[model samples]
Target: MAAAAPPHTDHKLGTPILDQPQLQAGGGTAAVTEKARTLDHISDNFSKYLKSAYDDVNKRYDLTTKEGLAKWLVTEQQASQDDVQFFKDGSFDDFIRYYMSGSASVMRPPPPLDDTYPISNYFISSSHNTYLTGNQLSSESSVDAYKNASVLLRGCRCVEVDVWDGEPPSSSSSEDEDETAAPKPKKEKKEKLGLRKRLELRFGRKGSPPPEDQSKPAAASSNQSPDQGADMRIEPWRSNVSTRAEPRVLHGYTLTKDITFRAVCATIRDYAFVTSDLPLIVSLEVHTCPEQQEIMVEIMREYWRGMLVDLPLDSSQNSEEIALPILRDLRKKILVKVKRAHKHPGAADAKPSTLQAPSGEPQRSSSVVSTSTSSSEELPDGTKKPPAPKAKISEALAKLGIYTGGYSFKSLDQPEAKIPTHIFSLSENTLMEVHETQPAALFKHNKHFFMRAYPKGLRLKSSNLNPSRFWRAGVQIVALNWQRWDGGMMQNEAMFAGTAGWVLKPEGYRSTSDEATQKTAIAHHNLDLSIEFLAGQDIPMPPEEDDPKDFKPYVKVELHVEKHEERNAQPIPGGGKSKGGEFKQKTETYRSQNPNFGGEIIKFEGIQGVTEELTFVRYVLSALSSSFSNCNR
Candidate 1:
């Protein structure tokens, strides 16, 4: 009411506030001082105004109440028009920076764990109950731990978080009711008396003396056959189940296959905010048969997701703080933490590169030096000092995963039979068909596949098609067959075949004399691709090779391992014959690499400066190639 009487005056600067003659006469310095004073007063007013505006808009636009945050995400730093407008409506131009480009706020403090919010209280107080917090009792000789309490903390309305809680589950003898007889109605039906069930299923008579001691008691008592091995140690309740994940009733066998793949998936969806781009990668690595790698696809897939999406952060979550142990690189994680700490709103984390004045030998200075410094010092050369590089906040992401510790992917023992049929595809060189015409890669599923194939790469072709006559057109495809052997059983091998490879010099195609002499490898790696055009069927390789006119399209078949029979078809004297079988492709000389830490595959995109790891990998590879060339000779 008091302000309404006077009609509040706007004191903001740059809005015609410098018209005062005192400020005008004193020149720019005086004007700036006047503007600063006005801004200070207006800042307080603007803060209040913005807070009110934000409160109103947040209630209206927060989509978590309806569609769920996981169901929506913009891949590749992009945003929709509706979102942009929602931001504008919130008056971001007046205040908000539209951080993470309308994605993440500048400062999102972690919810205080012990602060007793209803959710926090649930996670904390439930610990008092004998409910497990997801830790499989890694130590302790007991099948006696409790199940997790509501695993609901995973799908928190806020950013999903997961902590090792490293806290072990406890055992409470709080059975809902005895299976032998119901004294009263129970709260939950998951209770039972173990004795009655054992007597009914394991024994022919109730309360019968066990058969275990009856016949062997006298001999067994005298020849106590020593303690069972440490690993074979078992507990009464779960001695038959698995020693990992759950206590197995028997030492190597699984306890209850109750925890299924779908159950694991639901656990994630119900608890974590899994992005649409990923849920799980139902991958299969064809190793030997008996020990097929059969993990719930959900478990293996989340390692990467946890690497990028989930942070080991219950405290501060930033792109940098996610310590994806699966990624084995401490340095990479540190750099990421630094970047995330920098951009995080209100996150007062230490910056990794807090550039200190570089040792003071030769240094630069800010040209905005005060007049005080101008009069006091001058160099003998009489030139003004170069301006110092003022620190600017950049949105560049710092990734520190994969390059360290070497293994970019995990190799599991899985049978090809387990790999969904949709994931399999014929190699481009093998030339299988969709009605016998289209090239090999014409199908897809919801996962990703990468293949390096040479569709039409050869050393010679009919002069009509081979305009240059020196280089023929045909593709070289490398197929690495990986089969895992577990003890005596053999698992179906999953094939990682390249759909194509590069065209190389004619001599290298026939012999290993001049291998990989400058060629580009073409690889097709799309996750669920849609090849619209039909490449058609592959005609059989033409037998005649002497005349350039009779030359037919041929591909380089690279088998990591081939059978003796398959090897005969392409024994070209100096190398394997080109008719159909075992021949490795020429090595590529100038293949692109991620340029940081190196291996056959680039760790990350972009040409970063080379590091020591890249040098080591190159040296090792060079040595291997040298040995192979020597053997060929």
Candidate 2:
């Protein structure tokens, strides 16, 4: 049994950083291929199953009438009388069709009941390093992060892209194959500024002002001067500077090849709504120049014009941060979420600037191409910093992000007053640390905001964490490495297979529900669950050579709670003893494929609130070993 972790209070998001995707292993080809085949047949099978179930129910009772359906399906109010009448008039041919089409006559399973909640209130499947198909440093970056389908097809609502400012490497290279390449010297630069100076310059402030200018009145350069018009907007970055080489996608400090943004956008446009009708979020770890930024905006517009969520240009409507819109409000939309600087003093009056590529510009295509726009800065000592490409997000791109803005977060101890209701993304390591020390605090914060926890940097092998823990805390976006197929990925697939990349948050996480009331309701009464163990079929052969007919078998059961506490096991009749007290059955030499357990009943008691939603039971089957007395053995 795991201990229940507490939730925390609300906090705002910090500056946004690069979007990182998860990674994992190349799995057995046969398994993936077989799964793909099964998935292909799902729609047909699902329709048939629904048709059969409905036919059986209708034949057993009158399902075409309002009162009849109400009594039989246990949904009196939801099934409108008119809809029931329509069904009885033979307006619908198949119950499954009507159920899927949202006809009022169908008393479907509750349809994601928490519709009034914001986007932050739901759990969304996401991918890390979405472009990579192998180990981070030496992997290949393909447009298809998901081998079987697009990222969205894989049921990942949030996809990460690494944007840099140079032409991407054409092909992937193996770690050993790249060892002979020449290494660049770290100290090749003749002059370098201190950290403080770099920070000042990075934000567009002078590294060192002239004596005459320094003495002038502080208000003289006020960007917010009354004369400045609404058109004069503050730049997102202090300086149009970038240190990266090109505008391409790749993991940082890795030898992996890169994919062009234009190509990626094309892929997104083609596959946007194939597997899901919900909105798609593009998490950008952007480091690019202004001209390249323009190119990014243009190319994306060309490919995704219709589906992109165009934001309002009106100044008053765009300035304030707000909670995310609900899923239904953003269907088929693509939202780009990236970091923007908070307002600085006099920022309202700052004169905004834009850059246009030089005339007769080179033709741009899905293949890599360079931008003609250029901007550079000069230092006080007559030295020039590397020409960092400057880019200002197009006005169009800025609008779609009205509620999906990005922010960075370091520690909970920091002031959250500046944090906004926008999305907060953090590394899994940071979130796990918070979970360990202040589980309650993290839980509280997630109730009112959107949070994403991704795997840490060191998980180069593309491993995954236990996602259910984060989901329990109301963290909406828990990113996994879709490239690696493992138990975590399997769980992810299982959770989102039939649904559109979104799952309603548990009742405990609902914003409208009171956590205190929920806890109080569960304090006094305990739940009792009885499980029956029947039999096993086609048990695998042991590694040691043994006759299949002579195998001895026993069953064990373990309970898992979404907490840190230890679980106690109950005793079963005719059960064997074990160190962990896990439920176990006495050995039986059953040789047939279908071995019956003789109707063994295992009753569990003392279970309480939310455990049904959070608990998991695992059953194990093993060959029982024989013991011999020392003298008679």
Candidate 3:
């Protein structure tokens, strides 16, 4: 039964294998040779595993052969020479555990930032009703909400402020009087036009020449002489500015409490640039009278000093051909976006009535009234009438809306909607309707200008809509209710993870070509993704009292892609209505604190409509008996 065994030799290396352990385990030369052959077989399986299971790592490191992987582990991963030798000598499980625990296991790295593109081209992290810390209807508004949402969160760049007229001070002390006083502009005089010029303005200069102009030469009639029209001069028509109450921020038309607008401004000034130097967008919902609006403007100007971005009054910037400013140009600036008062055809020529006190009382010359009652009138029943419909947005406040001008959305086809500086705000439901009917139009419009979508009015509980729905259509400012930590907020956090509040959109969304607009889905790039559950080590126990042996671990894997559905487009095969649909798979449950999954592999083949850059894979770890789940993206 014991003929002498043959001496073992390493065939690949062409050397005799004479290790003492091998000699002892084998008990003879023939048994040692058999052991060497088994080691070679195990090494071959490990190489195959690296090529298939860790293909992404192989591609990343440019490794095509097992020898290359071994070299990389030693050189790049800093594995010891002994460890490499052990891997090559049949320690497959040990090598894999080491590699997976290191940096080689990272599936996604931080995305590179390209901030040179126009700000409209990026997805801005935004918050809706930023002052509300609870549900929309009855929440307490506080400045702390702004502090948390903007700086503490580290990425939100856009915040909302709904401003209303605050309660006036009880008595007009010297300090109170100074606070209510509006800063007046320096007066400048200009020469008014004579009758001939006035006639030309009323009619056309081409019409009948004036009696005084008939005697003049044809050249003088066609063009004004140096001193021809300079006859009478008067002060430019100025609005009778009245004293204002303190401006307040709150959720309008709700039971939400108010926070002083000055406090909000102070918070913004202190914390806006704390997390990121990128520009902060203050979306102002002005529900105040003109006087209080001016107070809002003064507060911002005083607090933000040089940081305020002054919007140019140039008409050309509104043209569709022009683009919004790039991020590189707007660093550390505060941009206010408020609804602009629409100018009618002859609005400039219409004379505004002087603001007079009620019942012929003396009007305050300093635009600071002694009491709030000075601005309101007593009704016949001794009750003051509700203040006149919130006055049109004041000129001073309108000027602060640099770059982003809030506009009421009518339709994409409207002329005003084409303005590059105009940001059309839409409710979630309205945006969904538009997406269903005219998705191509929505995508194309967002390419030139910004579109903001907020929660619908029915979201009284402050729930959030899936921002991805609007994001897929190239919507720039998807303002979510920051108070609720739901799936929408999770998705939002994932969207701007690496980038500081601004993420460049996908190429298809940024493209201006008609082909890009027409194509609703990304081209199918076939990829085979294989995920293997190797083992779980040191899994934490549940917080509550539970038996350790009863712990059963499982993982649910979900592949989320951009939902792309074209109206009237043919349905995808396998009863899928969308080209890129969600796919979910889970592993078998195992009962152990540290469970071994036994190398179970799940493969997804022919995945369609997925851009590696935009797609996300979510893994949810949970137990069968417990409702607790931990989601990782």
Candidate 4:
């Protein structure tokens, strides 16, 4: 039996691997003899940087020589014999240089974005619950635990944070004495109280008292029934707790210790524009009192003053009708996504509603300052929901959300009503249903306004929705839980790895013309994508019950596009087979760790050019269910 392959470590996650060298020959098939010039012709001069980057990875290889260059190009580029021959012949240098220097893995750079398009026409990498790293019920909330870095370094352009009134208590001493005897630490308590005061001044205060008997002893709250009294006597002693004095960031009802919004702002300021130079969106769920609301705005102005994209109060552009500035125009800018102010009834410019709440579901108000509480049955992910807001957002906070306004999304039933210019967010459950019911309408809406989709409340463990589905529907910001490192998260990373945070929308999805909105007619042409499987290096082992000894590895390539009917399909069968219009691939079996299929080809016949452009291919390796000999049969 052959030995199991060691895990591959050379290629890090989010790094691009050139599995196949894209070679284009001008007229003759013969390898060119002239030495390829350095990549000076390209508009973006990254040649010097590329050379240095390659050297950092491979200290032993000398890119100037044939022997060293040949080895590096073949391994790094996954170059075929023709490519290797061309390299040795000195004609492949420019192509090699381009691959090493370009941002996109596919030889050429993607087309420049159309600045004229609305913000919704660009795909944005986003995250949910930027505070938590575990299940909602018990996850710890911290600023340092892979928080801002995911947005700054990991291609995540949008982040979400739930803001609540008052500073979270630092220790048990602040609680009522009946709950604990320990005295409060003065330093910690002072700092928290100070922060709360500042925020109160910024947001207006309703000056309401704390809930009655909040610090009452648990024993007192219990009924005087003997059974309840007995249970309280047996329960362990705990510290009495009180309401906070300032606004803090926290997950829903989870008793995870909270951090102030100041920390969140600091994180954004320090890391903003560090990774990709694109506009970063902050989706704020504000539940703070009016004073704290003002504080939130004040802090934003103090810390993020220069970088914020403040909308002009008297600007003639109606946010509901106009596209905002392009991303390049908003570099280093923080675009705040908050709820638009309540519209007056019978207002002269009152537009028809462009959205419909799901059938039988109550219509939620568009106020960010106020929101309806979810019943236990409707609570997300089995985690306890937090109490309703204690106060509405202040006028100051509402004014701060001018440029990048936010709205709660319903359904696509109301086409006449239009969403505001800035943002609209929906839970994954709501989005998937909308896609199923009115995919075209959803796509059309996305072209005009930014749409964000986040995980459903039921994802208690912080699982994520498939971003591909959301992206296909033209949703700009498909937020995922960055804390969980699942396949969904990995794929999300893959999609944004080499490109900037924003990717242009597909042509058909970019315009709202009836012809573009209609289903595109597929062009038929025989196309062959031949892959030469030299070997898979350091493939990971199978899980338990799948014997490592019985492993028969093969590769599968899937084309993500509209599925074509099998009736129109034609496949070239096995001994290495090709299946057009279908995603599955077949290759002769190899039992060893480095299984070399020599040259296996996957072909696609009668596929349209539009399908080809929108196509994204995924490569996966798996063990054959049966023994190698049987699989070959």
Residue-level lDDT tens digits of model 3 in 566-613:
323223244332212278788998887667677898878877766554
Give the lowest summed-lDDT range of ten residues in model 1: 488-497
Each candidate: what lDDT? Answer: 0.20, 0.51, 0.59, 0.52
lDDT of 1 by residue, 1-633 (tens): 000111132111111112332221100111122232232122333345545655565455542333321122243223333444334333444233343132332222222222111110111000000111111111111111111112112111111111110111232443543344446535253245332332223222311222554323233334334552211121122122233222111101101112222233334344332211111111111111110011211232333334332123222433223222221121111111111111224333545232122242212121111100001112223432222112111111112211111111111111211221111212223322221232111211111121111112121110011111111111111211101011000000011001001112223222223222112111112122111111111122112223433322221212222222221222223222132212233222322111111122222222122211001011111211111100100
Assess candidate 1 and give its TM-score to the true structure: 0.17
lDDT of 4 by residue, 17-128 (tens): 1121011111011011021212224322234444455556446666556676667656766553344433333333544444533222333323555556556667777778
TM-score of each: 0.17, 0.55, 0.61, 0.62
| Model 2 regions lying over 4 Å from their true place | 1-114, 146-150, 168-246, 312-316, 343-400, 411-421, 436-441, 514-559, 564-610, 617-633
Q: Give the higher-TM-score candidate: 1 or 2.
A: 2
Residue 233 of model 1 has an lDDT of: 20
